[model samples]
Target chain A: MSFKDSYDIIVVGGGPAGCMAAYAAAKENVSVLLLEKDRDIGSPVRCAEAVGKDGLEKILEDNINPRWIAATIKKFQFVAPDGTVIFPQVPMTGYVLHRKLFDFDLGLLAANSGAKIVTKAYVNYLIFENDRISGVHVRINGVQHIIKSNIIIGADGVESRVGRWAGIDTTVHMKDMETCAQMTLANLPLDDDTCVFYFSQKRFPGGYGWVFPKGNKTANVGLGISGDRARSDSASARLESFVHDHFPDASILNKTVGGVPCANRLPKISSEGILLVGDAALQANPISGGGIATGMTAGKIAGNIAASAIKSDNISADFLKRYEKEWDTACGNAQKRYYRLKEGIRKLSDEQLNKTAHVLKDIPQKKQTLVKIFQTALIKQPGLLVDIMKTLNPFS
Target chain B: MILLHDNKCDFCGTCVGVCPENCIDLGEAELNIDHQICTMCYKCVWICPVEALFAEKVK
Candidate 1:
């Protein structure tokens, strides 16, 4: 088979969002191509690699193959700056993943569904004809090629040039951006079945640090500092200091540094013949910065819509807004409230975090329900109560 | 032509994508901007997150 000069849809990026978009769009037997800039599907791991099992299962149809799972967590531990630990026994599960393998598997599924997947194809710009997006010019293997497509899906990650080139205003505010550093460490004594989150404005101003165990003696330890606080000291330095102080004897296996956009969903996700999905559209959770499930959810919606529009021969802006409405109803509506709660919680001082833990320690063990715990922790921000409720219990 | 900041360059390669001339090549070892082929689009200067790329004198 030879490379085609044109396709029905072109997806730029090979991460989860891009793969899912290609998989969903190609399900209808339309000619689709997925372009990945990197030679490998997933080499440089970014996120903490921990995701809620229930949310992931709901999106993946409860068929998570064990091959991608690094570890399964049964409980969550919250640590305040004063050494107070609060274990929340919510009936939820967490999964620490081997991201390199998971990303490769997603790409394979996209190829199996009839989407042509290519690596090292770096998209340079969008082609315009009659003031509308026609296709993309990409660089693959030191050669430049202009690949035509009826529609373009910009599933490229944060700091996405696809959306910017299309004039979609994809800029993220510094306050809502998170600069993170993570290291996979070995020989550390950790609870493999627990996800521990540490809060201290002193160490991780405007954000937090986490340790998610991947195996019996190995773990992913990382911290994120809000962009506003990261101006002086890079996130790398902060993580290095935290790791040395907390896990002095731990040996580092791998290290990664990146940023996560923790802002509200873009006011506009679709324009003309282009649709931005996942981090490109700022679909990450505001407080948690978790985006895998959200990216898949949006990718599935955009892909199904794009293919349907191609069938009807109307890939117009008005028709594509159907995806916007559906996604807003599915996840964006809840995320609006999540953004507010994140801002309120991010401003909490280290003194307040310690005080809240002290108060919680004195409370009787029987009264420590998830709802009660959140209620007390957020008592000062009464204005955010209802939104927090919707955030904590999306089902309700 | 595009001048690079050796210290501020994090190898993000935002410039490679934004360059209209496609004169910039980001390899594993170095990010090179071929001055002979560059059209001086200056998009790379505006696109760099760290302000690592700049135009010393408009070509």
Candidate 2:
């Protein structure tokens, strides 16, 4: 009914990463506390709410929730700057999710694993002693509480204060950050199940605009521009103008605007008694800025590692180094490749992007696969071939 | 302390969500920062979409 004197692990932030961390740690019979600043588990969702099917399966395994799926899509369409529409039939398939339900369900799983789930708890400061983080000072329902913990998992997200408080360099450069805006629109004449992505330096600068179908008559329309490349308008303004120009008759149901860090992963993620997971550690895909899958994976690794470290009676970063190694083996290498590819693509001129679209368009549909698409995208950079090989054909 | 450049800000609330001090506040029509509570951490400055917030140097 009340707070405990101490916990084996404390996970700050109850997003997918936090929930997964709590669940994994609790499974090992460790006392884990999951704190969320928001009154509800999930509200005012900031994501565009889509995840690749293969990546999602790897993270969730057999624990897929049918209630959380809004749409399963296969068709892929890319729009270029000069109004060039290219349908590159690739092997990738994905699902647009109902994020609210998904986030709440993940937290429920964590609670079921015996982690103490506390909502409306805003962590104002880390309780540090002798250069080590031991716990946090959280305000729950206007009542301040000091909860002690041996290890802290920082899953707080892109603008995370947890990592910074623990003496990690959590600063993200402007070019590495994506200024994003999204609107859920209903009553639109969206006929296709295909997700459309519009790329134009003139419109979005370093990123692209996307429309993921939620159902027959509705879709989540959004865009993310490189923060440093943005000349004047905010992401929300650009998205509003884009929607007005493109989907004139569509009516908006909800809106959200925020930042998503698509930068390179930090060299160091764990410290004396703290582990930074998800966007806090910059695990989001550099190219797509989609992090749900990666965050979930990182949470599982960090949680399990924290539990093991507690049992070992050594809370040093040296003991938790396995978390970084495991993550690199899982998806870190691929993320690095994506970062390089993003940098390579950023230099491509608008005329060159249009040309690439035209070149891809002329290719036969039957011959167009994700491998070939990457080949086209990386024609200039031959070094990416190995990464593409590993990603497309992991076994070899 | 930190200063909020009103003209550059779009009031996206990204700064509000990340501020550990709860120094930054977003209203329906205005951006407010409580200077008393602000510790000059600069989390908001590094993450602001429009470069709205910045650290005020102490002389």
Model-by-model lDDT, in order? 0.81, 0.82
Error of 2 at A376 (Å): 2.9
lDDT of 1 by residue, A176-276 (tens): 77777788999999988988999998888888899999987899999887766665666677888899999999999988766788889889999888999
Model 2 TM-score (2 dp):
0.89
User: Per-residue error at A236 for model 1, in Å?
Assistant: 0.4
| Segments in model 2 whose C-alpha atoms lie over 4 Å from true places | A393-396, B1-59
Compared with the true structure, what per-residue lDDT tens digits does model 2 show for residues A55-170?
88778886788899899887877788998887766577788999999999999999998999988787878998887888999888888899999799999877577777788877
DockQ of each: 0.13, 0.23
TM-scores computed on chain B for all candidates: 0.85, 0.86
Q: List the residue pairs that clash in candidate 2.
A: none
Among all windows of ten consecutive residues in candidate 2 chain B, which has the lowest summed lDDT?
A: B20-29
- Tens-digit per-residue lDDT, B1-59, candidate 1: 57998877666544553354546666433578899998886555644545566788863
Q: Give the TM-score between model 2's chain B and the true chain B.
A: 0.86
